[model samples]
Target: MNATQEKHIAVVGGTFDPIHYGHINLGRAALSALHLDEVWFMPSGSNNYRSDMGIRAEKHHREAMVKMAIAGEERFAFSDWECAQPGSTYTSRTFAQLNATFPEVTWYYVVGADTLHSLKYWEEPELICNSVVLLAAGRGEQVTSGELQATAQTLRTNYGADIRFIPWEDMPVSSTQVRARYREGSFAREDLPPGVYDYMTSHHLYQSLEWLSDQEILDRCDATPEERGYYERLATMLTPRRLRHCLGVMHMAMLLADGYRNVSMEQARLAGLLHDCGRTENNALNALGHAPAGAQVARRLFGVKDESVLSAIRWHTTGRPGMTELEKVIFVADYIEPFRGHMLHLDKARRIAYTDLNQAVTFMGESTVRYLESRGEDIDPITLETVNYYRGLLKKQPIPGQYQ
Candidate 1:
């Protein structure tokens, strides 16, 4: 169907916190079934009531996600009409605006099965009923198909609304489930639409304290029940983006710990997870970087009694002269975690890390020293001293049981 020749169109509106395949599928089904000339992914939500509420992503972000989700689909378009509007929005007013603005087009408002049953109770049901046709995605979990058809008939009789159901067996994904998985640090690459996960990771969309109560956070730590509060506090301290990085480091540290005899997984897990606890919006504007401050915070506020864990967190940013194996694990993991795409020597260090611990630290130190020199930046004396120590240590002998 040509856009210029179009007479029929569908508007799929919701919060679309991070539009996923389920939403894309709904639009696709609408275009195919209704022979729609165009399907607009118009995000509609009131600032008054929201599923994610205050922590719900910014409207621009929601709009960007909708735009990204519908890209390359000729019939699928993104609409910022309602989302860009100021203040609370009612569906009736929104559709009325569309009708008045583009009277040539016949509009079909797309919604889920749950919304299908509640159409009349919405503000100005007659205006909504008279303005557009209703096309509901068939989410038949809580409510049955017979119930949806019955509700559709009731709406038609009472409000003179035209409601149609698309055949959706079940909605495989929901924003709540997606947010839960993100909070747990367990969402897979396939769980979201393309670019959505990367966008979420970049923006730190769902890593909030509110996203998890959080048993999910406790489970994600892979820690004991006693350590739950520490992880919870950690979640609250860092920004959402930083919290994700911490989880990545914690997971990577655990992976690296498996290869070394001296390193304990529990110790590595705790150290990696809390390595950045001192980070905040202000710490002398990052003049007091996280490493040393983190150790102090770990001991005082979090009550981490383990000196090994404290030492690991302390020197993670600046490698020390006589660093322990666990220290190297946290340091290496922080630098080489999977989420880091911007740092130097990441792939080489990551490869060498699993093979030889001593050589990995040596590589990390030497490369950082060189990068700092090339940039004409003031090299930290401790960093130079630590690099020298690792170089000399590499010459002397390899530590026992340090090889993968």
Candidate 2:
């Protein structure tokens, strides 16, 4: 093989504020599946949605930690191009740059099923897809064969793209759970890649970042008069089962927020605990039109104005028009909550949630669509539209004449 043909690389990139096991697993899986020559760990300097104002570690520190976490993985190497480059880092720009530098090499972008769903919204999305073959891992929320066929048929009639759903090994390890363990000071060596725990300890990443600690946020939420009032009022209104599920969602949200470093634990807990406050016996919660109801509850009771918190409440059930990071977190948490009994798709959501926000959003939204389908419930138009919007964003080829 020529030099250009010889180079086959899989790029597994993330913020790596606190690199953990899930990331390593994905890299290994991608490497094995693609038979790639190498997998590079590209730690983003900062995410556009998750800015430096709340970032606990500097770019150099985060990159170093990522380097240390994957130190022993022979196939893994670290790159800081995104961190070194000025301005917000984008995947299209990153891929364009890579292609420019290594025109002869074959590059396969490894992403979760969720990320694959939101390709259209990305910068130069169509161009990006044309440049490389995307390898997407299956998620918990993926539609069943019948549903997929129905949806695919609908898309085929509408758009001339073929949505190839790849079946891959599922990984349940989540960034959220890892962050929670770190916050409670209970993260074991096994929970993370070797040396990551020590790096976090030496760097004091979690302790310094108050929001990274879940217990602290829970304490803060309990201490805050507004959070307290909302909790107490909801306690009186909701049944014990609903309350327990809400608690489970909150716990999961806190874990996810901790893992991503995009939003605070306080925000996650607040949003997660309150996302379904509007859920009432009048409407089966698994039914449609619950998000707006939850939004109303947030406004009427707590008087919250922050876009992230309110958006989270509004889109937790069936997503609304536009969603923010906190909103996406709550949405994903509702679908992937630790308490879910029949979840076989945990790996898919976890894969995208940490690395890409848009992918995470699509994953949860599509999961919502699939969940309603499984129960023989009516599919809400807004939710379906939301899924379609993200599908467009991901540049996925629609199955013609179906689900349009």
Candidate 3:
């Protein structure tokens, strides 16, 4: 094949303990600049250069994250060549193995300018230099264009290495920053690839829940002193079991609020904490009217003034039609909190609540109707109204104002 038709592959290798946008950008730039057919991500199994950086994630987890980060890009692929090796892997050895495996394909190695400057210290620098073309992307302000050119000329003169520079805007993201965010329980979905973030949440990586204690949950709430005083007073009125349930609901409500833009975390916390304020037998609130009673108690006792929070408290048990976002949050939290005992379809309800709030609310309403019917109990009129309203929403039909 002529040069135009020849297979050109760029290899991008790194520790990639947790791949971020910087890594993805480097690969994409290499593909565009070098006219390469594909970019392969090689996550290092072990790095001798950074052995002092503390414990790294297992090879499988690192590989999984890389796979997720690169997904949906047909030109991007990954290799387990370094990860399959038993001990420390050198760049020279990796280059040699790749050359042997794809001798007909022209190879280019993508690296940051910082790594290019440190090339002399890596194992068998001359072999690494000769193995493939080096494409160095500019890093932060530390590496200037003049400095990169000078260094590239030196390597070309001394080691016969073909080096090219690619202009790259510095992205303020690193695996260390990602890990720190995960540990602090403040990691946002935008910081990482969608699939990678989903995987991290599912696998519970990077101490995701280490900050989920009762105090930690409360700390995340942006509550004023008066609101906290209300929380303290409400806690004293419940039995131990009921108190635990309330805390769990508060935690779940905060989590749900994080996924939606309109829902406020503080509103969710206050509404969740007081949703069951009237559940006490001594308080004279029953199953049929506990929600309305709780709303009154929230207004009279805690001085809650927000209509949304009061409406959420009033309708959490038997949801009304056309509920607000805060109302939906409390309603879903009460059903799916971690402390809630086993209930049919609860797991699916929790998943739906996080993924799609409206769907979860409708599911809960329909499921409750079915459950009450199975038990031969009278279905509450408000719940029937809620079920009809959301079902109408799902079907894109206009609901009557009476239900609203």
Candidates in descending lDDT order? 3, 1, 2
Looking at model 3, report the run of 10 residues with the lowest lDDT sum: 47-56
Give lDDT tens digits, candidate 1, residues 19-129.
888788888878877888899998864431121112455455566778877889889888877755543578899989998988789999877777876777889998998
* Candidate 3 wrongly placed segments (more than 4 Å): 1-213, 220-224, 396-404
The root-mean-square deviation over C-alpha atoms between each candidate and the true structure, in angstroms, is 19.7, 16.0, 16.4
**Cα error, candidate 3, residue 143 (Å):** 19
Error of 2 at 308 (Å): 42
Task: Tell me each candidate's TM-score.
Answer: 0.49, 0.46, 0.51
lDDT of 3: 0.76
* Between candidates 1 and 3, the lDDT winner: 3
**Which residue pairs clash in candidate 1?**
none
lDDT values of the candidates? 0.73, 0.66, 0.76
lDDT (Cα, tens digit) per residue for candidate 2, span 1-404: 46656688878777776777667776877876666888888876453223221234445456767888889788898887786653357777787788888887777777665665466667776556655656665654573445545644443344433344445556676655665678788878777777777766654554433233433333422335666667677777777667656765775676566556657768888888888888866656554466787788778866767767887887776665466668777887787664466765776665566566677777777776777678887776667766777767787653232356
What lDDT is reached at residue 187 by model 1? Answer: 88
TM-score ranking, high to low:
3, 1, 2
